[model samples]
Target: MVVGLGPGSPDWTTPEVREALNAATDLVGYTTYIDRVPPRPGQHRHASDNRVESERAAMALDLAKRGARVVVVSSGDPGVFAMAAAVLEESADPQWQDVPVRVLPGLTAANAVASRVGAPLGHDYAMISLSDRLKPWEVVAQRLSAVAAADMAIAIYNPASSQRTWQVGAMRDLLLEHRKPDTPVVLGRDVGGPTESVRVVSLVDLDPADVDMRTLLIIGASTTAAVDTPTGTRVYTSRRYHRR
Candidate 1:
Protein backbone atom coordinates (compact mmCIF):
# COMPACT_ATOMS: atom_id res chain seq x y z
CA MET A 1 0.00 0.00 0.00
CA VAL A 2 1.11 3.58 -0.68
CA VAL A 3 0.06 6.23 1.85
CA GLY A 4 0.27 10.00 1.70
CA LEU A 5 1.24 12.02 4.77
CA GLY A 6 -0.01 15.33 3.32
CA PRO A 7 2.43 18.25 3.34
CA GLY A 8 4.06 17.50 6.70
CA SER A 9 0.95 18.14 8.80
CA PRO A 10 -0.76 15.55 10.97
CA ASP A 11 -4.05 17.38 10.57
CA TRP A 12 -3.78 17.09 6.79
CA THR A 13 -3.30 13.31 6.91
CA THR A 14 -6.45 11.38 6.01
CA PRO A 15 -8.12 8.88 8.35
CA GLU A 16 -7.83 6.11 5.76
CA VAL A 17 -4.09 6.72 5.42
CA ARG A 18 -3.71 6.74 9.21
CA GLU A 19 -5.48 3.39 9.47
CA ALA A 20 -3.21 1.94 6.82
CA LEU A 21 -0.16 3.22 8.67
CA ASN A 22 -1.33 1.56 11.89
CA ALA A 23 -1.99 -1.69 10.10
CA ALA A 24 1.35 -1.67 8.28
CA THR A 25 3.99 -4.07 9.56
CA ASP A 26 6.67 -2.33 7.48
CA LEU A 27 7.13 1.18 6.11
CA VAL A 28 9.27 2.23 3.14
CA GLY A 29 9.95 5.75 1.93
CA TYR A 30 12.42 8.61 1.65
CA THR A 31 14.18 9.13 4.97
CA THR A 32 12.44 12.43 5.66
CA TYR A 33 8.96 11.06 4.97
CA ILE A 34 9.66 7.87 6.91
CA ASP A 35 10.83 9.99 9.87
CA ARG A 36 7.58 11.96 9.76
CA VAL A 37 5.64 8.92 10.95
CA PRO A 38 6.14 8.14 14.63
CA PRO A 39 7.91 4.88 15.19
CA ARG A 40 5.68 2.02 16.24
CA PRO A 41 6.62 -0.83 18.61
CA GLY A 42 7.08 -3.47 15.92
CA GLN A 43 6.91 -1.67 12.59
CA HIS A 44 10.12 -1.84 10.58
CA ARG A 45 11.07 1.22 8.52
CA HIS A 46 13.15 1.03 5.35
CA ALA A 47 14.31 4.57 4.77
CA SER A 48 16.47 5.64 1.82
CA ASP A 49 17.73 8.78 0.16
CA ASN A 50 15.11 10.72 -1.76
CA ARG A 51 16.98 10.15 -5.03
CA VAL A 52 16.77 6.35 -4.82
CA GLU A 53 13.04 5.94 -5.40
CA SER A 54 13.30 2.80 -7.54
CA GLU A 55 15.32 0.95 -4.89
CA ARG A 56 12.88 2.04 -2.22
CA ALA A 57 9.95 0.68 -4.21
CA ALA A 58 11.76 -2.62 -4.72
CA MET A 59 12.40 -2.83 -0.98
CA ALA A 60 8.73 -2.37 -0.25
CA LEU A 61 7.75 -5.02 -2.78
CA ASP A 62 10.32 -7.46 -1.42
CA LEU A 63 9.03 -7.01 2.12
CA ALA A 64 5.43 -7.39 0.94
CA LYS A 65 6.27 -10.64 -0.87
CA ARG A 66 7.62 -11.97 2.42
CA GLY A 67 4.20 -11.67 4.11
CA ALA A 68 4.74 -8.17 5.54
CA ARG A 69 2.00 -5.58 5.25
CA VAL A 70 4.17 -2.87 3.71
CA VAL A 71 3.24 0.75 3.26
CA VAL A 72 5.20 3.28 1.21
CA VAL A 73 4.72 6.76 2.61
CA SER A 74 5.00 9.98 0.61
CA SER A 75 4.86 13.62 1.75
CA GLY A 76 1.92 14.69 -0.38
CA ASP A 77 -0.61 12.77 -2.49
CA PRO A 78 1.44 9.78 -3.68
CA GLY A 79 0.02 10.10 -7.18
CA VAL A 80 1.34 13.63 -7.55
CA PHE A 81 5.13 13.64 -7.97
CA ALA A 82 5.44 11.14 -5.14
CA MET A 83 5.96 7.44 -4.42
CA ALA A 84 2.83 5.95 -5.99
CA ALA A 85 4.28 6.20 -9.49
CA ALA A 86 7.63 4.89 -8.41
CA VAL A 87 6.06 1.90 -6.68
CA LEU A 88 3.83 1.19 -9.64
CA GLU A 89 6.77 1.40 -12.03
CA GLU A 90 8.74 -1.10 -9.96
CA SER A 91 5.73 -3.38 -9.58
CA ALA A 92 5.84 -3.93 -13.35
CA ASP A 93 8.82 -6.22 -12.84
CA PRO A 94 8.03 -9.89 -13.45
CA GLN A 95 9.20 -10.84 -9.96
CA TRP A 96 6.81 -8.43 -8.21
CA GLN A 97 3.86 -8.90 -10.63
CA ASP A 98 1.94 -11.07 -8.18
CA VAL A 99 2.13 -8.53 -5.33
CA PRO A 100 -1.02 -6.42 -5.02
CA VAL A 101 -0.59 -2.66 -4.74
CA ARG A 102 -3.02 -0.04 -3.56
CA VAL A 103 -2.82 3.74 -3.23
CA LEU A 104 -4.60 6.04 -0.76
CA PRO A 105 -5.04 9.73 -1.55
CA GLY A 106 -3.92 12.63 0.64
CA LEU A 107 -4.06 16.42 0.35
CA THR A 108 -1.63 17.71 -2.26
CA ALA A 109 0.78 20.52 -1.47
CA ALA A 110 -0.63 22.64 -4.28
CA ASN A 111 -4.16 22.32 -2.85
CA ALA A 112 -2.92 22.91 0.70
CA VAL A 113 -1.08 26.05 -0.37
CA ALA A 114 -4.06 27.28 -2.38
CA SER A 115 -6.30 26.82 0.66
CA ARG A 116 -3.98 28.98 2.77
CA VAL A 117 -4.65 31.77 0.36
CA GLY A 118 -8.24 32.12 -0.98
CA ALA A 119 -8.49 29.98 -4.14
CA PRO A 120 -5.82 30.77 -6.69
CA LEU A 121 -6.70 27.53 -8.44
CA GLY A 122 -10.46 28.08 -8.56
CA HIS A 123 -10.37 27.92 -12.35
CA ASP A 124 -8.36 25.96 -14.92
CA TYR A 125 -4.79 25.32 -13.80
CA ALA A 126 -1.76 23.23 -14.71
CA MET A 127 0.73 21.67 -12.29
CA ILE A 128 4.36 21.44 -13.40
CA SER A 129 7.62 20.46 -11.78
CA LEU A 130 10.71 22.53 -12.60
CA SER A 131 13.13 19.78 -11.71
CA ASP A 132 15.50 18.91 -14.60
CA ARG A 133 17.18 15.98 -12.93
CA LEU A 134 15.10 13.46 -14.85
CA LYS A 135 14.22 15.62 -17.87
CA PRO A 136 16.03 18.30 -19.76
CA TRP A 137 15.57 21.97 -18.89
CA GLU A 138 14.35 22.61 -22.45
CA VAL A 139 11.29 20.42 -21.87
CA VAL A 140 10.50 22.24 -18.62
CA ALA A 141 10.82 25.59 -20.37
CA GLN A 142 8.59 24.42 -23.24
CA ARG A 143 5.83 23.34 -20.86
CA LEU A 144 6.06 26.57 -18.86
CA SER A 145 5.81 28.64 -22.03
CA ALA A 146 2.86 26.60 -23.28
CA VAL A 147 0.96 26.99 -20.00
CA ALA A 148 1.70 30.72 -19.82
CA ALA A 149 0.50 31.23 -23.40
CA ALA A 150 -2.69 29.29 -22.64
CA ASP A 151 -3.50 31.81 -19.86
CA MET A 152 -3.95 28.98 -17.38
CA ALA A 153 -3.02 29.30 -13.70
CA ILE A 154 0.11 27.36 -12.78
CA ALA A 155 1.08 25.35 -9.69
CA ILE A 156 4.87 25.02 -9.79
CA TYR A 157 6.64 22.38 -7.73
CA ASN A 158 10.39 21.83 -7.12
CA PRO A 159 11.12 25.35 -8.23
CA ALA A 160 14.57 25.50 -6.72
CA SER A 161 16.98 23.69 -4.43
CA SER A 162 20.54 24.16 -3.19
CA GLN A 163 21.97 22.70 -6.40
CA ARG A 164 19.34 24.06 -8.81
CA THR A 165 18.62 27.78 -8.30
CA TRP A 166 18.45 29.35 -11.74
CA GLN A 167 15.11 27.74 -12.78
CA VAL A 168 12.90 29.97 -10.63
CA GLY A 169 14.32 33.23 -11.98
CA ALA A 170 14.19 31.86 -15.50
CA MET A 171 10.61 30.77 -14.91
CA ARG A 172 9.68 34.24 -13.73
CA ASP A 173 11.24 35.75 -16.83
CA LEU A 174 9.44 33.31 -19.14
CA LEU A 175 6.06 33.96 -17.52
CA LEU A 176 6.64 37.71 -17.90
CA GLU A 177 6.67 37.15 -21.64
CA HIS A 178 3.02 36.04 -21.58
CA ARG A 179 1.61 37.18 -18.23
CA LYS A 180 1.27 40.75 -17.03
CA PRO A 181 3.89 42.22 -14.72
CA ASP A 182 1.26 42.56 -11.98
CA THR A 183 0.06 38.97 -12.19
CA PRO A 184 -0.48 37.47 -8.71
CA VAL A 185 2.07 34.90 -7.56
CA VAL A 186 1.69 33.10 -4.25
CA LEU A 187 4.79 31.85 -2.53
CA GLY A 188 4.17 29.07 -0.01
CA ARG A 189 7.09 27.68 1.96
CA ASP A 190 6.87 24.75 4.38
CA VAL A 191 3.08 25.10 4.10
CA GLY A 192 1.03 23.51 6.93
CA GLY A 193 4.22 22.77 8.85
CA PRO A 194 5.60 24.62 11.91
CA THR A 195 7.65 26.97 9.72
CA GLU A 196 4.88 27.67 7.21
CA SER A 197 4.96 31.03 5.44
CA VAL A 198 2.70 32.19 2.63
CA ARG A 199 2.84 35.53 0.82
CA VAL A 200 1.51 37.08 -2.36
CA VAL A 201 3.73 38.99 -4.78
CA SER A 202 3.58 40.14 -8.36
CA LEU A 203 5.19 38.10 -11.09
CA VAL A 204 7.88 40.73 -11.59
CA ASP A 205 8.59 40.88 -7.86
CA LEU A 206 9.02 37.13 -7.38
CA ASP A 207 12.55 36.61 -6.08
CA PRO A 208 14.38 33.40 -6.78
CA ALA A 209 16.28 33.68 -3.50
CA ASP A 210 13.01 33.35 -1.55
CA VAL A 211 12.34 29.89 -2.93
CA ASP A 212 13.78 26.50 -2.00
CA MET A 213 12.97 22.81 -2.12
CA ARG A 214 10.28 23.31 0.54
CA THR A 215 8.52 26.02 -1.44
CA LEU A 216 5.51 25.73 -3.79
CA LEU A 217 4.59 28.54 -6.18
CA ILE A 218 1.19 29.40 -7.62
CA ILE A 219 1.30 31.82 -10.54
CA GLY A 220 -2.17 33.05 -11.33
CA ALA A 221 -3.70 33.73 -14.71
CA SER A 222 -4.89 37.08 -16.10
CA THR A 223 -8.27 36.57 -14.40
CA THR A 224 -6.65 36.16 -10.99
CA ALA A 225 -7.06 38.95 -8.46
CA ALA A 226 -5.86 39.82 -4.95
CA VAL A 227 -7.97 41.86 -2.58
CA ASP A 228 -7.60 43.04 1.02
CA THR A 229 -10.28 42.08 3.55
CA PRO A 230 -10.75 42.77 7.25
CA THR A 231 -9.07 39.47 7.98
CA GLY A 232 -6.17 39.57 5.50
CA THR A 233 -5.31 39.61 1.81
CA ARG A 234 -7.13 36.95 -0.20
CA VAL A 235 -6.14 35.83 -3.69
CA TYR A 236 -8.41 34.08 -6.18
CA THR A 237 -8.96 33.57 -9.87
CA SER A 238 -12.35 34.52 -11.26
CA ARG A 239 -14.46 31.51 -12.22
CA ARG A 240 -16.32 33.56 -14.82
CA TYR A 241 -14.03 34.42 -17.69
CA HIS A 242 -14.18 37.52 -19.91
CA ARG A 243 -13.22 36.96 -23.52
CA ARG A 244 -10.26 39.05 -24.47
Candidate 2:
Protein backbone atom coordinates (compact mmCIF):
# COMPACT_ATOMS: atom_id res chain seq x y z
CA MET A 1 0.00 0.00 0.00
CA VAL A 2 1.21 3.52 -0.80
CA VAL A 3 0.41 6.03 1.97
CA GLY A 4 0.00 9.77 1.57
CA LEU A 5 1.35 10.88 4.96
CA GLY A 6 -0.11 14.42 4.95
CA PRO A 7 3.19 16.08 5.76
CA GLY A 8 5.39 15.16 8.76
CA SER A 9 3.17 16.07 11.73
CA PRO A 10 1.97 13.03 13.73
CA ASP A 11 -1.66 14.10 13.87
CA TRP A 12 -1.51 14.70 10.13
CA THR A 13 -1.05 10.96 9.81
CA THR A 14 -4.32 9.37 8.84
CA PRO A 15 -5.67 6.30 10.63
CA GLU A 16 -5.76 4.23 7.46
CA VAL A 17 -2.19 5.25 6.70
CA ARG A 18 -1.06 4.07 10.13
CA GLU A 19 -2.93 0.81 9.75
CA ALA A 20 -1.31 0.22 6.37
CA LEU A 21 2.13 0.94 7.73
CA ASN A 22 1.52 -1.46 10.55
CA ALA A 23 0.28 -4.15 8.19
CA ALA A 24 3.24 -4.10 5.87
CA THR A 25 5.92 -6.77 6.14
CA ASP A 26 8.58 -4.55 4.54
CA LEU A 27 9.09 -0.81 4.10
CA VAL A 28 10.97 0.86 1.26
CA GLY A 29 11.61 4.61 0.92
CA TYR A 30 14.29 7.26 0.77
CA THR A 31 16.30 7.29 3.99
CA THR A 32 15.04 10.71 5.08
CA TYR A 33 11.35 9.95 4.59
CA ILE A 34 11.68 6.43 5.98
CA ASP A 35 13.24 7.83 9.15
CA ARG A 36 10.08 9.89 9.81
CA VAL A 37 7.85 6.85 10.16
CA PRO A 38 7.74 5.69 13.76
CA PRO A 39 9.72 2.53 14.21
CA ARG A 40 7.57 -0.53 14.30
CA PRO A 41 8.88 -3.94 15.26
CA GLY A 42 8.68 -6.95 12.95
CA GLN A 43 8.66 -4.95 9.72
CA HIS A 44 11.67 -5.45 7.49
CA ARG A 45 13.17 -2.20 6.15
CA HIS A 46 15.16 -1.42 3.02
CA ALA A 47 16.31 2.18 2.88
CA SER A 48 17.66 3.68 -0.33
CA ASP A 49 20.38 6.22 -0.86
CA ASN A 50 19.43 9.58 -2.39
CA ARG A 51 18.57 9.55 -6.14
CA VAL A 52 18.65 5.74 -6.34
CA GLU A 53 15.17 5.35 -7.69
CA SER A 54 15.96 2.52 -10.08
CA GLU A 55 17.63 0.47 -7.40
CA ARG A 56 14.87 1.07 -4.86
CA ALA A 57 12.21 0.21 -7.40
CA ALA A 58 14.02 -2.98 -8.35
CA MET A 59 14.42 -4.01 -4.73
CA ALA A 60 10.79 -3.38 -3.84
CA LEU A 61 9.76 -5.29 -6.93
CA ASP A 62 11.99 -8.16 -5.86
CA LEU A 63 10.37 -8.39 -2.42
CA ALA A 64 6.90 -8.12 -3.92
CA LYS A 65 7.80 -10.75 -6.50
CA ARG A 66 8.52 -13.08 -3.61
CA GLY A 67 4.99 -12.52 -2.29
CA ALA A 68 5.90 -10.20 0.55
CA ARG A 69 3.33 -7.49 1.24
CA VAL A 70 5.65 -4.53 0.97
CA VAL A 71 4.83 -0.88 1.52
CA VAL A 72 6.63 1.54 -0.81
CA VAL A 73 6.29 4.82 1.05
CA SER A 74 6.66 8.33 -0.36
CA SER A 75 6.66 11.31 2.00
CA GLY A 76 3.67 13.02 0.42
CA ASP A 77 1.12 11.58 -1.93
CA PRO A 78 3.02 8.78 -3.66
CA GLY A 79 2.18 10.15 -7.09
CA VAL A 80 3.38 13.71 -6.52
CA PHE A 81 7.02 14.41 -7.39
CA ALA A 82 7.98 11.32 -5.43
CA MET A 83 8.72 7.60 -5.68
CA ALA A 84 5.52 6.59 -7.42
CA ALA A 85 6.88 7.78 -10.74
CA ALA A 86 10.07 5.83 -10.22
CA VAL A 87 8.15 2.71 -9.28
CA LEU A 88 5.85 2.98 -12.26
CA GLU A 89 8.62 3.72 -14.75
CA GLU A 90 10.58 0.74 -13.52
CA SER A 91 7.54 -1.51 -13.39
CA ALA A 92 8.04 -2.32 -17.04
CA ASP A 93 10.50 -5.00 -15.95
CA PRO A 94 8.95 -8.29 -17.08
CA GLN A 95 8.86 -9.96 -13.70
CA TRP A 96 7.22 -6.97 -12.06
CA GLN A 97 4.66 -6.18 -14.77
CA ASP A 98 1.72 -8.09 -13.36
CA VAL A 99 2.37 -7.53 -9.68
CA PRO A 100 -0.27 -5.54 -7.86
CA VAL A 101 1.04 -2.07 -7.15
CA ARG A 102 -1.05 0.05 -4.81
CA VAL A 103 -0.61 3.78 -4.30
CA LEU A 104 -1.73 5.51 -1.09
CA PRO A 105 -1.89 9.29 -1.16
CA GLY A 106 -0.02 11.46 1.34
CA LEU A 107 0.21 15.24 1.70
CA THR A 108 2.80 16.58 -0.70
CA ALA A 109 5.60 18.82 0.54
CA ALA A 110 4.08 21.62 -1.57
CA ASN A 111 0.79 21.43 0.35
CA ALA A 112 2.66 21.35 3.65
CA VAL A 113 4.67 24.42 2.80
CA ALA A 114 1.64 26.15 1.31
CA SER A 115 -0.38 25.69 4.48
CA ARG A 116 2.26 27.37 6.61
CA VAL A 117 2.42 30.36 4.24
CA GLY A 118 -1.34 30.98 3.97
CA ALA A 119 -3.12 30.60 0.64
CA PRO A 120 -0.24 31.23 -1.70
CA LEU A 121 -1.35 28.26 -3.71
CA GLY A 122 -5.03 29.07 -3.33
CA HIS A 123 -5.05 29.96 -7.00
CA ASP A 124 -3.33 28.27 -9.93
CA TYR A 125 0.28 27.51 -9.12
CA ALA A 126 3.21 25.48 -10.40
CA MET A 127 5.47 23.02 -8.62
CA ILE A 128 8.98 22.61 -9.98
CA SER A 129 12.02 20.69 -8.85
CA LEU A 130 15.11 22.88 -8.99
CA SER A 131 17.46 19.97 -8.53
CA ASP A 132 19.06 19.48 -11.89
CA ARG A 133 20.73 16.33 -10.63
CA LEU A 134 18.56 14.30 -12.95
CA LYS A 135 17.30 16.89 -15.44
CA PRO A 136 19.23 19.47 -17.44
CA TRP A 137 19.67 22.77 -15.65
CA GLU A 138 18.87 24.63 -18.84
CA VAL A 139 15.48 22.96 -18.94
CA VAL A 140 14.88 23.84 -15.34
CA ALA A 141 15.85 27.45 -15.94
CA GLN A 142 13.47 27.67 -18.89
CA ARG A 143 10.63 26.38 -16.77
CA LEU A 144 11.49 28.76 -13.96
CA SER A 145 11.48 31.68 -16.35
CA ALA A 146 8.20 30.56 -17.85
CA VAL A 147 6.52 30.17 -14.50
CA ALA A 148 7.78 33.56 -13.43
CA ALA A 149 6.57 35.14 -16.64
CA ALA A 150 3.19 33.54 -16.13
CA ASP A 151 3.06 34.87 -12.59
CA MET A 152 2.20 31.63 -10.84
CA ALA A 153 3.32 30.85 -7.32
CA ILE A 154 5.94 28.14 -7.70
CA ALA A 155 6.66 25.42 -5.15
CA ILE A 156 10.26 24.46 -5.71
CA TYR A 157 11.39 21.03 -4.49
CA ASN A 158 14.89 19.68 -4.00
CA PRO A 159 16.25 23.23 -4.24
CA ALA A 160 19.83 22.39 -3.43
CA SER A 161 22.05 19.65 -2.05
CA SER A 162 25.76 19.16 -1.46
CA GLN A 163 26.41 18.61 -5.15
CA ARG A 164 23.55 20.62 -6.68
CA THR A 165 24.05 24.02 -5.11
CA TRP A 166 23.97 26.45 -8.02
CA GLN A 167 20.52 25.68 -9.36
CA VAL A 168 18.61 27.38 -6.58
CA GLY A 169 20.46 30.66 -7.07
CA ALA A 170 19.97 30.39 -10.79
CA MET A 171 16.27 29.80 -10.17
CA ARG A 172 16.20 32.84 -7.92
CA ASP A 173 17.81 34.99 -10.56
CA LEU A 174 15.45 33.67 -13.20
CA LEU A 175 12.40 34.38 -11.09
CA LEU A 176 13.75 37.80 -10.25
CA GLU A 177 13.66 38.65 -13.94
CA HIS A 178 9.88 38.81 -14.04
CA ARG A 179 9.07 39.15 -10.37
CA LYS A 180 9.62 42.02 -7.95
CA PRO A 181 12.26 41.62 -5.30
CA ASP A 182 9.83 41.54 -2.37
CA THR A 183 7.74 38.51 -3.34
CA PRO A 184 7.07 36.24 -0.39
CA VAL A 185 9.16 33.08 -0.18
CA VAL A 186 8.43 30.16 2.09
CA LEU A 187 11.17 27.72 3.02
CA GLY A 188 10.28 24.46 4.65
CA ARG A 189 12.65 21.86 6.03
CA ASP A 190 11.61 18.46 7.38
CA VAL A 191 7.95 19.44 7.13
CA GLY A 192 6.25 16.78 9.24
CA GLY A 193 8.63 15.40 11.83
CA PRO A 194 10.30 16.45 15.07
CA THR A 195 12.94 18.59 13.35
CA GLU A 196 10.69 20.50 10.98
CA SER A 197 11.43 24.18 10.27
CA VAL A 198 9.30 26.67 8.38
CA ARG A 199 10.30 30.23 7.58
CA VAL A 200 8.71 33.06 5.64
CA VAL A 201 10.91 35.53 3.85
CA SER A 202 10.98 37.80 0.86
CA LEU A 203 12.58 37.03 -2.50
CA VAL A 204 15.27 39.67 -1.92
CA ASP A 205 16.12 38.14 1.44
CA LEU A 206 16.44 34.51 0.36
CA ASP A 207 19.98 33.31 0.93
CA PRO A 208 20.94 30.40 -1.24
CA ALA A 209 23.55 29.41 1.33
CA ASP A 210 20.71 28.47 3.67
CA VAL A 211 19.33 25.70 1.48
CA ASP A 212 19.97 21.98 1.65
CA MET A 213 18.44 18.80 0.29
CA ARG A 214 15.72 18.73 2.92
CA THR A 215 14.40 22.21 2.12
CA LEU A 216 11.49 23.22 -0.12
CA LEU A 217 10.92 26.79 -1.39
CA ILE A 218 7.60 28.34 -2.26
CA ILE A 219 7.79 31.54 -4.32
CA GLY A 220 4.57 33.53 -4.33
CA ALA A 221 3.13 35.27 -7.39
CA SER A 222 3.05 38.99 -8.23
CA THR A 223 -0.44 39.41 -6.84
CA THR A 224 0.57 37.77 -3.58
CA ALA A 225 0.65 40.38 -0.84
CA ALA A 226 1.45 40.73 2.85
CA VAL A 227 -1.32 42.05 5.09
CA ASP A 228 -0.99 43.41 8.62
CA THR A 229 -3.64 42.27 11.10
CA PRO A 230 -3.82 41.63 14.84
CA THR A 231 -2.74 38.02 14.31
CA GLY A 232 0.40 39.37 12.60
CA THR A 233 1.61 40.54 9.19
CA ARG A 234 0.39 37.74 6.93
CA VAL A 235 1.15 37.09 3.28
CA TYR A 236 -1.50 35.55 1.12
CA THR A 237 -1.91 34.34 -2.44
CA SER A 238 -5.55 35.04 -3.00
CA ARG A 239 -7.82 32.37 -4.42
CA ARG A 240 -10.25 35.08 -5.41
CA TYR A 241 -7.62 36.94 -7.44
CA HIS A 242 -5.51 36.31 -10.50
CA ARG A 243 -3.65 38.36 -13.10
CA ARG A 244 -3.85 38.09 -16.85
Q: In lDDT terms, which candidate is top?
A: 1
Summarize candidate 2's per-residue lDDT along 1-244 as a digit string, tens digits.
5666767786777788788888899999877667877888888888777658888888888898898988888777788778788887888878787777777777788887777657778877988888776789889888888888888889998898888888777787778889899888988898767788877788988899988988989888988887767765566787776545
The true-versus-predicted C-alpha distance at residue 102 of model 1, in Å, is 0.6
For model 2, the superposed segments whose C-alpha errors exceed 4 Å read 229-232, 242-244
Clashing pairs in 2: 2-104, 4-105, 4-106, 5-106, 6-107, 8-192, 9-192, 77-106
Candidate 1: give the clashing pairs: none
| CA lDDT for candidate 2 | 0.81
User: TM per model?
Assistant: 0.98, 0.92
Where in model 1 is the C-alpha error above 4 Å?
none
